[model samples]
Target: MSGRRTTHEDAHDPAPTWTPRLGDLAHDSSADRTGVVVEVPGDGVFSYHLRPERGGADPEWTAPADGSTLSPADD
Candidate 1:
């Protein structure tokens, strides 16, 4: 194989280096998951699986940061 690495799919690729109020997120409590776009990876992938915003807390009940997205609760 070539030295070049295969890139991650772009459709789901998250942008890197969010400038605070910079990242957009999707949450799935049912899936017990959350994610954020970060730049260090440079793969257009989430920096890491987002754990609860705080240790052992329910992030869903938490308020978002200023300018952060707050989708209408569908539950």
Candidate 2:
């Protein structure tokens, strides 16, 4: 068997462009998570938040933007 551990790769489809994280909000660094990019919404802040959302699903904005603002993606 392949010693390499299994990552969050699709079974039928090929691997996604990005990976998926459980609850990482700050999209500062390109993480191994799935999702596009939203506005940073902050100045002087060298960070961004990425969630499994689209259209209007905004990232966290209050505090700890990457704490618990990640919402589920729609089918």
Candidate 3:
């Protein structure tokens, strides 16, 4: 077998287990912010588009789809 260790083996904590979907409320732990999933990355896209949940001044931002920092927002 290849000697290279996997990510889970090297990580001090387990990686997150969530994926964002269109219209789903998501939390960006890296940014410490929560927003609505406005758009999900498509064939050529590599990021997720999120908008403020309460129509605030925050501009829509894109988050990586790596599934390590985003999780479903708490209700």
Candidate 4:
């Protein structure tokens, strides 16, 4: 086998150091939904999930991205 590692081999790597907390507001432009951080799976940053701000169905899991796209929603 080659000395270089493959993408699949990196899957087990640790998650980012930062994670969103519960009640934090997040915005997903692709979904056009601004939701509140409802759960953090403790697996990693990507495991963080959110719920719709207006209240509705269960929140969906989302990938962790730079905070530039997400900010605390106004009260």
Candidate topping lDDT = 3
Ranking by TM-score: 3, 4, 2, 1
Question: Of models 2 and 4, which has the larger lDDT?
Answer: 4
- At residue 20, what lDDT does model 2 achieve? 24
| Least well predicted 10-residue stretch by lDDT in candidate 3 | 8-17
Q: Report lDDT (Cα) of residue 9, candidate 2.
A: 62
Off by over 4 Å in 3: 1-16
- lDDT (tens digit, per residue) of candidate 2 on 8-48: 56445554343324343333323334454454435764334
Tell me each candidate's TM-score.
Answer: 0.21, 0.24, 0.71, 0.46
Q: Distance (Å) between predicted and true CA of 71, model 4?
A: 2.7
Return the clash pairs for model 3, or none: none
Clashes of each: 1, 7, 0, 0
List model 3 lDDT by residue over 1-75, tens digit each. Answer: 988677865667665577788899988988888999987878978889889888778888888867567889999
TM-score of 3: 0.71
**For candidate 4, lDDT tens digit of each residue in 1-75?**
878765875777755544467888876555666888876656565455678787877556564544434555556
> What is the C-alpha local distance difference test score of each model?
0.36, 0.40, 0.83, 0.64
Q: Where does candidate 2 stray beyond 4 Å?
A: 1-30, 54-75
